[model samples]
Target: MEMQNITLSLPKPILHRVKILAVQRQSSVSRLLTQAVEKMLEEETEYEMARRRQMALLAKGFNLGFRKPASRDEIHER
Candidate 1:
């Protein structure tokens, strides 16, 4: 894969915490951020696929096997 470098700015306190966390995990901050972004994109793609499937099912509708509509009087009869 081709790699492109970009600049990012973060608050000092947050950066400091991230640095510590990276060290504890034995990883670099860049690697941690990359993993987080990858996870977010994966989840978004999965959500979109599920949404499309549900929409298709709704559009296709379902069959309840009823041949004809019942009269209102029949429905209301005790």
Candidate 2:
């Protein structure tokens, strides 16, 4: 994979905290940020994929109206 350089401006306090965290974890700030971004992107991708699948399934055949509606007896049994 190709590497890209990214520069971010952060508050001094936040930067100090990040440095402490990096030291405790024994990881560079760049690696930590990269990992965090990758994780969030992966999670967002899954959410998008799931939403698309749900929309597609709904479009094919989904009923908003009730069919063979359950009676109060059915709900009370559980």
- The candidate scoring highest on TM-score is 1
Error of 1 at 77 (Å): 15
Residue 71 displacement in candidate 1 (angstroms): 5.1
lDDT of 1 by residue, 1-78 (tens): 787888999999999999999999999999988888999999999999999999999999989786887899989999
Clashing pairs in 1: none
Q: After TM-score superposition, what is the CA distance of residue 1 in candidate 2 from its true location, in Å? A: 2.4
Candidate 2, 1-78: lDDT as tens digits: 899897899999999998899889999998888888999999999999999999999889967786897789997996
lDDT of each: 0.94, 0.91
Considering every candidate listed, which one attains the maximal lDDT? 1
Each prediction's TM-score versus the true structure: 0.77, 0.72
Give model 1's TM-score versus the native structure.
0.77
